[model samples]
Target: MTLNKDHIGGLIFLTIAVVYGYFAHDIRMFPGDQFEPFNAQTLPIALAWAGGLISLVMLATAGRSAEPKPTLVNLDFMLVGKLMVLVWLFAQALSWIGFLAATILFLLVGYWLLGERRIRTLLLASIPFAVGFWLLLAKVLDIYLAPGKLWQLVLGA
Candidate 1:
């Protein structure tokens, strides 16, 4: 059978879903939290299942599609690679810098990598969004996020 965009997309989606599910299964739970209706691992595991199901359905129904085969000639693979590296760095930064600082740096650098150069525009775009998201996760959701290793060492937080 000839592969089309749908088939490729489905395969990629399936791979991501499976990987996500695998990690979700490893999530640690607090004592007695497993018996609760929802816990730390609940949403991730549920999303993984949903993603897997959707991807499987996508693959099953991807027998044929009108969409043209994706072209690689114009693809900016260097940018993609940079973005991937950025993501890795962000993960590393999370442990060292803490959630808020790491997030702020990630968003700012991500915007810059995507070609946003204006100083005001970059700050305007990244800062508020990062702060707001941090607030949402820490305040609204009451999720405890560490401030960062830098802050702890410098400010003795």
Candidate 2:
């Protein structure tokens, strides 16, 4: 059996799932949350198990694939590095510019990095999606999101 992309991906996914499951047990809960049916670790552990199962299925079905293994010489390492930087910048921007603003910037920069140059497309794609997701997390889920240092300084909110 050759080690194709599917094999490598399945192996990586399985390894990460196992590691995540191992760490999920360490998630802390509230004083009385331990006795509940679902707690801090429940969803994580469930996702780990589901990922592990899916990875196993992928591994099993990967053996019969007809495609030959391709070399990685054509891989876009520079794009990957840029994306990594973008994610790091987004994390840093979250505290400085707030979730909605940071998310819009992240999507805009990501789309630009992927060779999209149209400003209208960038704004249309990023703004509405970021605002929708922000509303979902903030309004629908009732999660507490910081207004960011810049917003707080400017608006005093």
Candidate 3:
């Protein structure tokens, strides 16, 4: 039997699902919490089973039809490398620049890298997203966010 892309993808997804299910099943519940309605492992195990079932359906349907094979294209390594670097820089800047500023900058740079040339649109989209996320996590949720080293230095806070 010839292995098609769908078959290969299904096998890979199946493997991942099995691994996820195994880990999820092995998660230890707290003492006297065995009868609880929900636990940490519940959702993960359910998702793993769902993924496994979907994978089985995919594998079973593979090569059943005479569909044309899709053409493959060469990957752009330079673009991939740039995205990797961008992610690394974003991680590094997260603490130093704080969540709000760093997220806005990251989104702006990401949009630019993905061929967004309009400054007004970029700012309009990114600023609100960053500010909203900050407000949601920090203000509404009462989660602590780093004030940023730069802000601390500038404001002496």
lDDT (Cα, tens digit) per residue for candidate 2, span 1-157: 6798789889999999999999999888889997899889889999999999999999998888765686879899999999999999999999999999999999999999999999999999999999999999999999999989998899988
State model 1's lDDT. Answer: 0.90
Lowest-scoring 10 consecutive residues by lDDT in candidate 3? 65-74
Which pairs clash inside model 1? 97-148, 98-148
TM-score of 3: 0.53
Candidate 2: C-alpha RMSD to true structure equals 7.9
Q: lDDT of all the models against the reference?
A: 0.90, 0.94, 0.88
Angstrom error at residue 3, model 1 = 15
Highest lDDT: which candidate?
2
Candidate 1 vs. true structure, TM-score: 0.54
**Backbone collisions counted per model:** 2, 0, 0
Worst 10 residues of 1 by lDDT: 62-71
Q: What TM-score against the true fold does each predicted structure earn?
A: 0.54, 0.54, 0.53
lDDT of 1 by residue, 63-110 (tens): 866866777898899999999999999999998898888888888899
Angstrom error of the Cα, residue 117, model 2: value is 1.8
lDDT of 2 at 130: 97
Instruction: Provide the global lDDT of candidate 3 against the true structure.
Output: 0.88
RMSD of each candidate relative to the true structure: 8.8, 7.9, 6.3
